[model samples]
Target: MATTPAPATKPLHLVYTVTNIQHKVRMLDGTKVSYSSWVKLFQLHAKGYKVMSHTDGTQSPAKTDTEYEAWAEIDAIVLQWIYGTLSDDLLVRVLVTESTAYEAWSRIKAIFLNNKGSRVAALEHEFNNLTLKSMSSLEAYCQKLKELGSQLNDVDCPVNDQQLVLQLVRGLPAEYDIITSYINQILPTWETACSMLELEHHR
Candidate 1:
């Protein structure tokens, strides 16, 4: 039979696109107000907090309404650009906390550049950053498990001694125990992220 050449495979791709949708609120008012006035209005509408500007309107005075609007527009543009690329839950969660959101944004940029664009890069970045110390401990234990397994494999033992290998594996519960512990550790962080995102439970 004649053989046909197969087409080349492409790397998995995921693209996030920002949509021009309704409900896009302007972060600032169109009125040309002083910095203090602008900030006061913004807080009143968005956060229900009353804010007062203490600056003397010099040396980096509060943002002008236009300047403030421009920055807000930039934020919307950036966020819109990244919107659909993230799971809705993740988006919502990060939006809840400025710290978490900024951390996520920084990590996302680093990961996209570092990995040449992969959603896995984003996930790995979040995972590694969020679970550093625990992950280090888990990795060390996993390495030990692999070393012990290798030692057992290299020994000159009869096939019947497979039971001995099983015994050795069974006796060392550290690896399995650690895996469960790691999972437990991850669950809470994930839950926190999800909660911040405002995703409701299925149950």
Candidate 2:
């Protein structure tokens, strides 16, 4: 009986085209903008291979022929995707060179993730200094405050509801004395405080 040979597997590069990536994950630029989204996209694309640990060449046992081959293919694909997304300057600066995908991933994460503390501190400083000018629209001011608060929360330094409300009330100009007094008395949530301020602004 003649048995049919198994079909050859397609090359990983052809299987996953760079163009097919709806949102390409770029190298980490200084700005953290779109970083979370990029990380999510890369994780989704590199599922099953993204978190694999890199061998140290001494501590780890030698990989079997099949295992080595599989790792090589996946490593090439992952590196290609990562390199493709990087800016030319960044690619030149942080070139992964002979490092495995895991090493590259770790290095990139360390570069960006290490500055989280400074980021949180900067956001807190911004929140402290933010003020609602007399001429500023109440709605716009509130939106800016909320946006800053959201950014703080993203970095795991979220301002509590009570503190946020207090901050908002305190940041108001002297012209909003009556509304501020009313809000402070009740110690309302930030949303309620914003609403009250909005009403006062409209009046």
Candidate 3:
């Protein structure tokens, strides 16, 4: 029988609070963390106001006083969240005298989003250079690979199944050659490959 593996440690969660509204999720450091944080942050604010895809009236009808008021409230909350979550250094550098939540959000996005290309390059470099050392635990190796793949996906540069499977096999030590050969023949999905590797580790 295959023994169940212990679960991995979870990352710290990031929380946002203002007035009656409270939101929390795993920590976000702009670049290292998953881009899902970006989506989640927006969604949290979207609950109170329309933040995503908001127009500036040049293309559509101008907002009414009531609409503007509601927007302003949500923007303030979102701004608070951004200010609260960012590191002291980043907060100091990115902070601007913007009056609206949209402006603040756009400024932060401009700072981070513009670096996607460089971030993608760095991730790919790490992926290519990754290798399972003889002393390393298989679980740790697998976790690292999955993390890099996930971060890449978050930034709009997804690693396909075949590439992930291939990379894993290629990076294994020589002792894993026989199993790697078998894996190549089967061409299993990434999750299945991970399970098989874990099972092999147990054996």
Candidate 4:
């Protein structure tokens, strides 16, 4: 008869301050580190952060202040609170209104990459001028998108813009449900229009 397996050892509970935890996670064998090392990860986890471990962490992506993911992470954290998993603390405050602002800005970024030339620049301008006071409802976002679409009609498409847009939208954050909702509603229209335009221009 096989002997009973030895009692399993309890997993370690390591205490960590909110600060410096990110550094610890970046160290050796750190992926296996406990939750508290970066409690923020757990908080994000609850809110559905899909891009935790980048593909081959060895190849560092540019960590620029202007990088969309940096701002996206903030939106994700705020979304957690909006969804009620995270509590707003003095140190980790997240305002829903601010998160909504970024949501619109990210959508503008999406439109910019999908189109080309002066249209992208025009979208960048419009997004820069988007005021919190002006866009009080989701309808405002839809109107903004329509306004951008008309502007795109005036610009020439880049050679690879279609492929680039497909890849970028495909890779966008899944937790931004509202964005995804609008995407689902609009992507079919985008594909049909772009495909027809490409065929006309090439043929």
Maximum-TM-score candidate: 3
User: How do the residues 36-74 of candidate 4 rate in per-residue lDDT, one tens digit apiece?
Assistant: 222344435423433333211223235564655554554
Which portions of model 2 show Cα errors greater than 4 Å?
1-64, 80-93, 115-120, 132-156, 160-169, 174-203
Q: Rank the candidates by lDDT, best first.
A: 3, 2, 4, 1
Better of 1 and 3 by TM-score: 3
Q: Write down the TM-score of every candidate.
A: 0.21, 0.53, 0.67, 0.21
Question: Model 1: residues >4 Å from true position, as ranges?
Answer: 1-62, 97-104, 107-203
* lDDT values, one for every candidate: 0.33, 0.66, 0.68, 0.38
Better of 1 and 2 by lDDT: 2
RMSD of 4: 20.3
- Top-scoring candidate (lDDT): 3
lDDT at 97, model 3 = 74
Taking every candidate in turn, the Cα RMSD to the unseen true structure, in Å, is 24.2, 5.9, 14.8, 20.3
Itemize residue pairs with steric clashes in candidate 4.
none
Over the stretch 81-126, how does candidate 3's per-residue lDDT look in tens digits?
6666666666786688765655655666666567899988998999
